[model samples]
Target: MFLRPEDAGTVTSPTLIEAAPNEQPVLSGGVTLTGWRKDGSNRLGLPAAAQGQVWVADVPMVGGRALAFRQLWVNGRKAVRARTPNDDNLPRLLTWDVDKQEAWITATAVGTLRQAGQLEMVLHQMWAVNVLRVKTLTVQGAKVRVTFHEPESKVQFEHPWPRPIINGKNGSSAFYLTNAVELLDQPGEWHYDGQRGQVLYWPRPGETMSSAHVVAPVLETLVQVSGSLDQPVAYVQFKGLTFAYTTWLRPSEQGHVPLQAGMYLLDGYSLQQPGTPDKAGLENQAWIGRPPAGVELAGVHHTRFERCQFLHMASAALDYQSSTHNDAVVGCTFRDVAGNGIQLGKFSDEGTETHLPYNPKDEREICTNELLENNLLTDCANEDWGCVGIAAGFVRNTTIRHNEVSQVPYTGISVGWGWTKTANCMRDNRVTANYIHHYAQHTYDVAGIYTLSAQPGTTITENRVEEIGQAPYVHDPDHWFYLYLDEGSAGITVQDNWCPAEKFLANANGPGNVWKNNGPMVANAIKQAAGLEPAYRDLLAEQIKKPAANGAQVKQ
Candidate 1:
């Protein structure tokens, strides 16, 4: 994340600007692309189907690079990245070798492409995705062998649990190749080739290059509220604003191997000795890095965001990075974010061991007393399968209430971290009265409400969860639940939640967890009052499209 020290930040009320009561302000982080030329008139070679339909533009160089970006926005909406086997016809993995970090596939499935190293293999596992960059592709007669670039190759093959699952619960895992010039056969798709220093696009219907407002994101963060533990930025409030069009560039530079909840692995490997001093069954060690956010906060106290819109961000929409307390994110709309909608507290530090419990000597290091209430989170985590609607890690005295979360790919809400049954600085968090549905769009081993680690006095109650979306490519169709408390989840009382059935999970739990009246038997009145108490129901009427099971967004 970039530190903008020159920006105005102070305790003085006038120094911080707030939008007028009736005005809607938008803070955007995008650059417009210009000078498009038809591929039929240019010398660039395209596929037969894309000859007259494609358009090319010279990529403006920035610091000796071809304008680093992962996504494009045409007419205020996202354009699909060029991928082979276009939408939903993913090929199944034949075999994967763990030792050599290689995968074999049917030869003819991937046509003879020119750029072998640029192809990215997106393999869907049980709970996450493994994005492997192809290093070499050797095609024999009937079978093709592909190798990956490191350290993603080590992290993809050697990581534990969700690593490259071949034969899963039902069928084998599926994958597809993307980011090659040969894959630009469909309209409304785009590709950026660094070798040629240009970008190519096949426009959608009714989109003309002369009038299309195409935006390419260059900055990772639009706004940042930063302070220190000693003197925090306090009593600042923002209202009626929109943050738009920011993209993260780390995944395109170094490989992205997610651990869980959109936290990528810096380095990870399974432990030979599966025991630690805190927990006896620990089997893995990992160091992780967090994705960027459009709006970030650190060492901020008593800050709030109200009636704001977060859109077109490549990573998380909003994040309280660390040492934030008594902050509230209320009545906000988060849409089209590639990562999590709301991320609070610390998952794991880049240099710290992931499984180890965190209890900083200074108590301010832990996030506390956060309020995430009455927000509308939709169409987020659409690309990152490891992310969720709301993710809170190592937070204390926080309350997540009366939110509506839909159209996400993984878990609706995930709380806590460390995955250990030991005590630390997390307790008394409340997740209550939220409506979560249409989740698990493309991945499984998830739930509407999930928890981890040993939170002392947490409670999850009166939430309504239903309609786990189907995706035929998931590893296990039956691996989902309405409410789940994973390893070391203790001192949590889950009661009075309404779901379709009695589908819940408590895997390798620790102690002192209580469950009561959480299924179909729950009272109708409790279910009625579960999500978005009367005033916030207008959020659903904004025409948010639901993601199809085939990984495409369609009108609901």
Candidate 2:
């Protein structure tokens, strides 16, 4: 029944407040807009021009519409500008143009949010905010709680590229390489150990195999299978992306799984070495393999590796030499390398380059092309050791951060930039938050970290280092010592880093070096040690041996 105009005022509610023209009306009482207050008594009718700016408390109630609390209103005067809280659960639903797939969100926030297969952030009116930071992403089952910057800005996750590859493989370098190139168009699935049935790589006469087409070989040693077969190779091409491989060991029962873009799970399998150490108790299989020439692992642009493990590599775990940008290797493990564990910036002898320098001068004098970040290593000492754990030659924009290195015979992480070229070649390379321990055993001048002649502006910060010894007289002068900064390496800031120094290291006693933050933990430990030097030393020594206690740790 249609109520008379006179009777409409009976349902008056005093708690409701009305807004003047050009103002957003705020409801006073708790009984606000729920499609229930249709009575004309307290209804704040709008002028014709601003009518759409406010939703009537109950215009739709006459029909079979349910009285719901959530309603979207657009500020018609503002041209559909949106605003809402940054809380994902409390997202204020704006006037969604469903047909056009356009949403108006107010402010912007930084941090990762899950959308289908990728992790990303949302921006709204990007010019409105200054620093766009998507600081964190917390995943709770299917519910992702995102915290953002502006309460008003809305963001959309529409674009999707190929996801960056994350964990894969275990202890087998052959399997690691194979998994790295799984998406490429190869003739057959990559295989290891030829006798088990599939094609494998072995040394043959003049095979002419490109890096893309080569297969895992079965060595003639019978114990370490290294042989090559006649198989078509594949050249893998890519653009901006990241691929992280770690934690795997080959087995007869379990098969090798390929690496893909995005976060992946790795399996912990066993690796069989050819023989045991002459001194150690275990007889492990030992057939360390070497990487073929020009084998590319990472590509150009914005990649990161966190908490990865590398094992049983006859060659480098990472063979990236291209002029890449914004790449990082973080929170990873490297062990048993026949070659370098994390190899950087490839080399070519086409012109008159000769053999690649152990650490190139031209590499570090450039921009940040590669970085080794927060990586850990153990049990990497080997009889046939070839290179450092993290080696960068002729590269730039490299940062080694919060890394915990141990048990490697060679240098832990190194930078040899500008050695081939000018003195000021590498710029803005930072080695920070690293805990390098127990190194320089097999190799000498083997610092916890070494930077051969790099350019100026290379900073080493907040590194807690221990157990690095001077190289024996017989080893190359380049191989021994802790914190080796040689060959015109200046503007180097060694600040706030801990090291077990027999004495202060002096390189030619030149003037330009900056040593700001240098100290030892023993002094601090002695304070807590309550005057017992032996007890304090023993306790501190034990803590340093454990991986969890030693490195620059990522706070949860």
Candidate 3:
């Protein structure tokens, strides 16, 4: 909570903070971590096979630093960050060099892996993801090289395209090393140690560390709502809210590259002078950065967020962050967000240049008419596997309809940004009858309604988009699709979308695009009229933690 604005000027009136009718109100940014003194988990350095099953704590510092978060939340779920091929296996990546940003790992003793610069690898790269940070691991014969650190290791080896592909397509590219206190031997696993501010659990089953309930996330952006573009921040309204705990430590401070729906990648490169008047021999050059939002509006306008409930955030859960206009996120309910569950408008503003094309001479900086209807995005980009469940960049008339999005990992409704097929500032965007299902769950060249650049009266109609989740550590399991209009998808208008065959992916599209009557003979009344519209279908049984008396939704 930056705590400034106590009359620091500029708030041209018009604000109304709802929720008193059936009371929802939960806006927390977490910080409850009482004393918790258990100590000795092998003197708290934990490694002799988790030295008598880890459990130690003392962190708690708050305003004076050292609470060290990476997501904890004990009493109400989420707690397993000691990672290292734990459970979901995740290892392969036996050689890479992208000019020495290094990575070898076939694995072997490798000097018993201890802190090693607070370790954190998480590399899985097919369509973006590059955590890195290790900086030295050596053994190099039967493998285990690793390297990286500085400036995200030169922006993850000269950032070209969602990078880190070694062999390509379903092969050498899956990783996960994570915050190791020597991977704290199982039981719900944990570990934080920010150089001994300590905290190292291992409880699970009937946990009881003197009345359990931890909680760590200490604010990244709880509810900003600032104003500018000529004193905006107009008629604000936030009905029945819930937005909970937030924290996205900037990939533990400097080392997270991403360049797709999740947006990180502070500075990408590759452009030896690649054309781009409307994109032709265009050489990438990204800039992105915007993740951190548990409700963060900016230069707002007719603001509105009905039935709100973007839960447990660590990154992007409701962010109309730009000169937002006629805002409206109808029946909101983005679950367990880790990144992107509705991040409409402007995706290249860390200094612009994300392939240019974002024309704005003050059309109020352009995020016009936004309105995501019947929303209920579930699970949501769980720990940023390249986030997306409705991420709309450089928006104009945005109006995604009947939203239903499912468990999501990568791309389940992402719309235009400047990959450029010319024509800037986007146009009349509108993805209709949305239902997008299971989704790539882990990263692929994704698409269940994906798009990029040039949007002139955009229209992806009657979307039902089927299952599509088969993650076995993807690089490209048959690429993936069900409406992907990537790279300069111009003047869009894809018709009657259903999906179960006729796959769909129009990669370098441009010039008045249009594809009619999409897939499986498109019928069944357009796949039963897409999703969530019978007055929001009770938000498809909404839930981030809904349980008592059968509310359901805590399964993913």
Candidate 4:
């Protein structure tokens, strides 16, 4: 059963007060309560909510309509906001007091550094940084006293980049501080002291603290519909609802390292490799582990997500995993996500490896006949730079069309699984009529459209891709392409695609792939080959009058 907001009645409850330490308020499902009061104080002091605890609201089904909450408003406004840690270029490094376990940072005033916080160092990799907590801090006239929880080790190596390397070992480097009141010197910088229950902020230029609204995401997952293979959830629909503010916490067992799309997994690596071409090191996978999503549907069938908004999420917005079929996500918007916008199917080899000579009749479980159409995905992969806008692995009979994906740090759309031409049930997928651009901005060896392994009946056609591999921070050979057919990818057709990039296609030893009329003149060639010059011309004329109609419909 599902419920929309209109089907439920609003209860006139008093403002929810924050619980004392070790106490939490339990919210039942099937009811909706606004999170804020008229006085601007949060009815729910989620900032003080304990970790790993979620305040859930259940929506009851009444007369076939499911009761739902409209939104989670905070400080009199929608609480979906940017979470990038504020940073500025490192100031001149002064002397390091080794015995004191502190480094003297040049500053104008002690201002906010008097509080405890964290220091970050990004020596080489973009997504992987070394972080150390601040134990104590002091401020002088023009220099600040900063002490780390641990002592810093220094090593030296050579790199081509001009940025200064601090505590670099074997060509690796790092340098910066964050999450401290003293370091909240730049606009948009914020820090919270859990011990004292205080939140500190430095507003952006032309902004004042009194007018700024501060919010911290308290939920890890907004919605999850999980069914087993024997009892799949069916006939569910989510329309015109805005889902936001899921949080992701870095694991304590390991250092904070993000794989593709800001997915923090137990074992992950960056796309950038160490050493020069002549002395190459081991190549790493974009992501080696999986993370959760904001809206996850597993073993679900015959469902629809239409005209929905998924934003400000710490993980993938829409993840349709194992055993999902006959589903559609149409006319939706996914932006400011820390992970992939839409992900279909789990990666092959995620579990125990099934050896070769695999039985074809062994009850293969895959998401099939899924449709992703007419959506806009942008500014995704904000935390995980290696994730794509739309990604699928071990999927079959899927259609990805008419979507506009831009400003992503990695591939726009990626399909298939397995590193080799092994038959893993990924077949008959179609990627067509999409506009993908402004990608590969952070990670490398990506494209507007990327495929892997052998998928015989797959086709890539009639897509427009531009301004790819133009990131100012990316300066490697990996930053090049429109279409990438990687490792053992074969039996695919690439035709009639309009790409004005430096390279039209990249094949990684893939065979049996057909490339025909894929370039800047592909539109004309498509018309000439199909003998529809007049119809094509008329379509172009119609497109010119309303360019927005060429892609997903922009919601009013």
Candidate 5:
């Protein structure tokens, strides 16, 4: 996701140096660009001299990771397709038309879009391209000028250049492409002091005595800032807004079971597509409700919880650890969870199960930098019965993608920590393409993507397991089997997955475990428990290309 072949500039006349070559036009990069113009208009970048439509309403929606388009010119050479709106089809919006260079694109074809009118270009090829929408945004004084209204669409804007702040606080602001639409239409008092470059406010909704300040919920205005420079907003979208109470109450001594997320903004919506269900997950339930015993919990960051649905929560419907980061709990759905639906570490009972074997001075640990992608868990545990769908330990570099665990009961995807000793506890974690199934058996452990006593580059890839047993014979399976390694853990890589094996099980050692190139019912017990022989089992049976199917699907 990096494109920069000579900063191509020029909407009708933006600039990067041009006077020759047919009124000076150069955008050659790979092409498939568009802004909007079939009578909609949006090719923004103004301030060199500013003009018209308030120069596209003073262009100001910027956030990054790639969603750039600048001088794209390609008219009759053909080869620039774009048409995808959801289902992860990928492609938000794009258009270009600088004096008849003619471009027309939508997004999500993957590659190919290089025209020849203004000289368009765009060769992404695949992967990485989240969401990039633009209504109108410009800042010539700080450079960010683009404007186009259909004539033809191509795209341009290359190399590290996407920074336009103005989210919310007092002096209201909203309009971001890379990310700007979490629910903030108005409210005031937000300043960045880099010489008046970032400011937001509205301050008149409820008047409020104005001293302690903090009122979030904007998408049609409701902001109230004070002064306290804070930054952590990559993407947030919550509509049907509701932000309440915020937390601060203490009275728990004899038997503590209290935790707080200290809500500032909960139940937010942001252009959520794919069969709409966001309103904090269908009909508002956004909460922060309990906090008293010492009060100090703040949650929700890098927000996005589509199709949100919850019930009876004890905690962790989506609790971002302390100083949150990179959060994304897409297509959410949880039910009757007394606790544990999506907890990326921290919010302790030391680690549930009523303090499990974990009892470190009452425990109140921390681990953030969250991400629980594509979620959906069901019937979580009740009455503090200990349930875990996605639980990390002292979290680090978290990423749990394409999720879909089922009828929860205990352990479906648990990583790191049996207690807190801490030392790079959970490093570079990634539990990808998940779809764990029916968990219920506990009484000790119910494994399926479970790792404990943490350590060693954890990565459990390409997951898919079936109805993990609950009875009949007490099945219970999944690697590391029962790791402890004196509570330090190590380099775990259980690759190319597909589960459902019940018979031979007995590797509770937990010392430097490795089961490389995994696939095919644990591939001969990971070569006889890492003793390795029989020519490494024909080199792990020639890397077992893909023959372990049983069940897994969320794809809705």
Candidate 6:
């Protein structure tokens, strides 16, 4: 029998309270829960409930093994399991100070006010959520002097920029401005002032504060099956469960400027740092770092997550880390996630050292034999722009096939990690039969399918990618490509792919890679390779069409 919190009546409903005049309502009275907090800090103790509640259950173990209970249902709807205090709604910016990188916003009077140290700023951009830190917020007469802590080097100004547009056009540039607490200026907007210990909100036009059913996320993970190298968690199956509302706590060291899709580590380092030899062999080299995922799996084997739903998460839905072998995430739906949908392995080239060791003959270790198939990943990378839909770093013998990924901020599928062609453990990874499109909407130097390093047995086949937009940087065109083999990558095969893009393929010093039967003209060949009968051609055609709802777009 599937055990659930509701089955035993362990879940409690949040207590609702009336809103003060001109303020938002408050929801309280939920139990506290504990788990691993974000920011890689120490494991959190029993934390107090914020806008959401928590439930704890004790199940009798059999033979000293813990029971696996993995679902949280709330009021008949499957509640999402998130990190902490979800940021589903963001207040609009009232005014801007482009020079100081500050913004003006208002907060309604409601609930417990967040302190300065507890608050973080999130800028909703097209395809990305730029998470920032509030340096100083000084309330003036009507507005707050909100100063951001971003380094001057990270900000893109109008003149004398490294890459300038000769046409004097208004490219998508990072912008911000200051704040203060006053009467709710607009509907569906909220503001929090730590100095006054107040949270204010302006409800949507037809919405009432008293009738609002708020569900804030208080948990970081719904299910975790961890084992050590000596004893692995093998042969576990998690099927037909919906996991939601995992949160990403704001880091203490703020000023997290994203290069793309909230991938902050990719901000400073460049593949083309002046003195460094151009490793990728591209005229312009812009590379960044990778982050962790929400559903972390380490030192486990033969695990399967089938027909699961992962939504409203603060980070990547699934992450397979060290010693994770022969795992599969099949027929799942990952939507509205803050990071990537699936992350396999870790990025090899981290820290200041740019060079990586070459081990052409070393056998694959840590991660192998993974399969990700028939999943729908959409509206991901909501908070981090640098993340992709499916990211594989230093993994071998992995298969990512028959998935549909769209409306993303950066690349759709990213494989391999090392910048140079130096051989690592990444090999024999296959990306096939997926439909990817409407991505690269915010940042730059990306594609529908992007690969790095020299993975000898990598093959990309029969995928359909289209409508990749350009980066916000200057001197770049308004469109990207379907495939990118970057930075000394080699021995890969790109075959029978249907890419109706202005540029079908790109290579950055990648050698010994083969491209066969690709581009729009090869659509029929791609269909045939993917085993789609002629009768199913129309269904495939419809699947390639852009989705109706592409989530929020960056306001020009």
Q: Using lDDT as the measure, which candidate wins?
A: 1
Per-model lDDT: 0.84, 0.35, 0.77, 0.55, 0.34, 0.54
Q: Summarize candidate 6's per-residue lDDT along 483-530 as a digit string, tens digits.
A: 888766788999888876437555564577998888877767565444
lDDT of 5 by residue, 1-556 (tens): 1112122222343212212432312111122222211212222221121112110011123253222221111221111111211122222123333354322333222122111112112111110010122223333332233332221112212111111112212111111111111111223212111122222222333432222222211111011111111433323433221111111111111111111111111121222342222112222111122212101123324444443443223334444445445555555455544345665554334213211223234222334456676556665543222446666655667778666666665556777653222343356777776766676443123455666544557677666655654321111123222211222355666665656443112133245556544444545433222211232223212321111121111111
Ranking by TM-score: 1, 6, 4, 2, 3, 5
Better of 3 and 5 by TM-score: 3
- Per-residue lDDT over 232-332 for candidate 4, one digit per residue giving the tens place of the 0 to 100 score: 66666666555665655542113244333333323322236553222234243322356667778876777787656676666678888788888898877
Overall local distance difference test of candidate 4: 0.55
Model 5 regions more than 4 Å off:
1-133, 137-316, 320-341, 346-364, 367-393, 396-423, 427-454, 457-490, 493-497, 500-513, 516-518, 522-556
Per-model TM-score on C-alpha atoms? 0.94, 0.39, 0.36, 0.64, 0.25, 0.65
Worst 10 residues of 5 by lDDT: 245-254
Q: All candidates: CA RMSD in angstroms?
A: 4.8, 30.0, 19.9, 12.7, 26.1, 13.5
Candidate 3, after superposition: displacement of residue 305 in Å? 2.2
Whole-model lDDT, model 5 = 0.34
Location of the lowest summed lDDT over 10 successive residues in candidate 4: 543-552
* Prediction-by-prediction clash tally: 0, 73, 1, 21, 70, 35
Instruction: State which candidate, 4 or 5, has the greater lDDT.
Output: 4
Judging by lDDT, tell me the better candidate of 3 and 4. Answer: 3
Evaluate model 4: give its TM-score: 0.64
